[model samples]
Target: MPIIDKEGNFLAVADNVETISNSAAIADVMAQFANAEILGIIFPTHHDGRGYSLTKKLRRAGFNGKLRAIGPLIPDQFSDLIACGFDEIEISDEQFLRQPLVQWLAAKEISQHSYQNNNSTKTSIFQSRRQKIAANRHLNLVRELP
Candidate 1:
């Protein structure tokens, strides 16, 4: 659902910082990102992927304040969005009507693993399988050694 409503149920606090540029120095916002009560990144369109990269960068930079994604995004990307450190997603009414909450929730479970170095969830099938194989091998060695 949209983050904000006509009645004002859910909302994001606007930052007082003046200039926020994609290519600007993120160091400039270290203090603001830390001190601000709320912070967010807006994706003008689905094609613009700066938000995804920026979200990870902000979180890593220690922006513990509220992080929200404001744009029209597909339900399938919800998990990645959250994993990248988004607390909530703000989409248009038309987007909500088409996908709805159920669709988003379902999309959240689309993948159990992420190939990205930094993400919300840590469930990678390849990594998981490797760990299991190592554990099983260790167990077999112990059983034979005694």
Candidate 2:
């Protein structure tokens, strides 16, 4: 399995990662895994979205460690996964071969702007629209004053 950062950089896999299944309850393991240096959330399948929910819970619980999503996932989901708080994604060799590094990079580029805010650094469509509206309103007001 090859691990990739959100920026599409190939990352050296950490040997000391604490693994947890997506099905595990966050409340049950919060004390143990929350303080881990690195945590790996096992996603049995891309279709299983429990991992995303779990990640959110862990983050809210103050799990500030490196969070890794390990499973079979497509390049399309890269942005959503990052927004969901995954620091790195571990993909199978077959998926890597099929999608290639370029696809992952492209996905990262596309993630720069998104429709939903989701607490990510990327600017949301709503926020951009609001900024533009405010600028236009300011310009209109200035014209009226003159």
Candidate 3:
């Protein structure tokens, strides 16, 4: 399996990674890997969404360590995986060849303007609109200052 970071850069797989099953209880899994430096969540398949929720849960629980989503996830999921707090993705060699690094990078770029407020760096459509309005208001106020 090849590991890719949030920026779609290939990364050497870390050793001694404690990967937990997606089906396991969040609390139990957290308790087991609380002190782990790096953790992996086994996604099982492309259709499994539990991994996303699990990532969010882990982040909310204050697990500030690195997280990897391991499975056959598609390029389209790259952005959401990061938004869900996953630092890296581990995919089979076949999946990597099929999707390629460019595909993963493109998918992430396409989702840069997503309307979700999940990722801090990526601004939502609502935030963009609010910013525009504020800027316009500020301009109007400036014009009136004359």
Candidate 4:
């Protein structure tokens, strides 16, 4: 079980999405939006990726709070992790021991383009991809019309 703050925010841990949904009061925090400050989504294990969806859901729900990934995530997944909307990641002690601060910094250098690139000089792949998809869909619809 996770704790829900009086302000209505709670951790979006991998196994806790259901609980959050079931509790109307807790879920209302996200709807209200103003009260949320930090939202934590747990990854549980290195292989589990449910946190990504949780982050996405929070973003789509208009939660501009500090979204954090709390688990034993490796630096290699930082790109996707960030693109999924996490402001920071918190790993377990064992993972920190396995990959030091230097390694994590190096991971940041591995990618210059995330799908949701926010760097001022770069455009998000999502924007370009959306344009192409819409164009393609229009073409298909035109071809089918006559």
Clashes of each: 2, 0, 0, 0
Model 4, C-alpha of 15: deviation from truth (Å) = 22
Candidate 2: 10-residue stretch with minimal lDDT? 6-15
TM-scores of the candidates are 0.76, 0.89, 0.92, 0.58
1-146 per-residue lDDT for model 2 (tens digits) = 78888777987655778899998987876867768888999989889999998898888888888899999988888888889989889988888989888898887776587788775678889999999999999999999994
For candidate 4, what's the RMSD? 10.6
lDDT of 4 by residue, 1-146 (tens): 23222122333354322223211243565655435565566676867877777666667776776766666777787666766776666666666767766676666665656566541334578888988999999999999996
Worst 10 residues of 3 by lDDT: 111-120
Candidate with the larger TM-score of 2 and 4: 2
Q: Rank the candidates by lDDT, best first.
A: 3, 2, 1, 4
lDDT of all the models against the reference?
0.66, 0.86, 0.87, 0.60
- Please, what are the lDDT tens digits per residue for candidate 1 over residues 111-143? 656765445547566777889999999999999
Residue pairs in candidate 3 whose N, alpha carbon or C atoms collide under 3 angstroms: none
**lDDT, candidate 1, at 74:** 76
